[model samples]
Target: MLRFILGLVLVVGLWSAAPVAQAQNADIEATISAQLEAFKVDDFDQAFTYASPTIQGLFRTPENFGNMVRGGYPMVWRPSEVTYLELKETAGFLFQRVMITDAEGAVHLLEYQMVQMDGTWKINGVRLLANPPATA
Candidate 1:
């Protein structure tokens, strides 16, 4: 009888945990989507708000952040098309994979680092990933 009760409790616990994890994933995706939308319109000020405090500190101001993104990550600044791929969590940080096509039609893979601050998810950093070669 005790064994059955313990199993039931474990099942209940796992079931409850699943939704929390899903909610977190949804929130993280929403944050990234909102930032991308802001970028679409060149709304640097709005985009900057989605950055984590550490990133904001490093860039100092919205214009500075905007300049960096425009110069260093042109694909992100003006992506022809964007697609969300996967979200993974490691060491308490979330990483989201995104596929972006540049204006010239080159595809780029990027991983976005996200951190939660004050119960809100904010973008910490973005790293460009190498695209695999295409075989015909």
Candidate 2:
């Protein structure tokens, strides 16, 4: 009965934590989506707001960040369609996988490194997935 009680408590604790995890996932997704929308309109100032401090410091200005996106990540800059995939944690970092269809209908899989700063989700970095799964 002692074992049973401890098991029950563990199960209940995990079950109750589900909603909090889901809410966090939603917030992370929203942050990415909002940045994409800002990019669509060439609003680099607004898009830069979603970036983590490290990223902001690296770029040093919204225009520099915008230029990098326009040249290095054109798909993200002008995605024809956007889909959110799994959010996974690896090496103590949270990565959000995104499937973006470029204006020409080409699909690209990208992983976004996300971090919470000032109680808000911010994008630390992004990289194209080198080996994405086969999609039908």
Candidate 3:
């Protein structure tokens, strides 16, 4: 009887948790997820849509931009356990900081400088930081 009750409780818990686990991504998470998904599918055109105007000028072609992201930053190209750490406003624009953990358990801190033009936040640049000490 005790085992039956425990099994029933576990089943009910999992059933109730499904919705939250599958919930829609928040604004910041959605932006990052969109970019990642685009890159994963090799859709540079779709990925470029998220870039700020300044970024567009820096890398005119999708190939150039994708190459920069893939080769220069292999950590970001193949990252796991990505988490949005913070979103802070600077001057009149907003900046987001995302922390990514690689397959080898290395942390890659990325600073996504954002600017809101006409109400939509666009990523202007990505600054990769050196991995902090394990204690950090």
Residue pairs with backbone atoms closer than 3 Å in model 3 (clashes): none
Measured with C-alpha atoms, the lDDT of residue 14 in candidate 2 is 97
Task: After the best TM-score superposition of candidate 1, give how far the Cα of residue 94 lies from its true spot, in angstroms.
Answer: 1.4
lDDT of prediction 1: 0.91
Tell me the lDDT of model 3 at 98.
86
Question: Candidate 3: which stretches are off by over 4 Å?
Answer: 1-25
lDDT per residue (tens digit) for residues 86-131 in model 1? 8898897789999998899888999999999899899999999997
In model 2, residue pairs whose N, Cα or C atoms come closer than 3 Å (at least 3 residues apart or on different chains), thus clashing, are none
Number of backbone-clashing residue pairs for each candidate, in the order shown: 0, 0, 0
Per-model CA lDDT versus the true structure: 0.91, 0.96, 0.76
lDDT of 2 by residue, 1-136 (tens): 9999999999999999999999999999999999999999999999999999999999999999999999999999999999999999999999999999899888899999999988999999999986455578
- Per lDDT, the best of the predicted structures is 2
Tens digits of per-residue lDDT, candidate 3, 17-136, equal: 866434421555676778877877778788887888888889998888889888886666677778887776788656677888876888888888876667555778888877656783
Which of candidates 1 and 3 reaches a greater lDDT? 1
The order of the candidates by TM-score, greatest first, is: 2, 1, 3
- Pitting candidate 2 against candidate 3, the one with the higher TM-score is 2
Misplaced by over 4 Å in model 1 are 1-12
Q: In model 2, how large is the Cα lDDT of residue 112?
A: 99
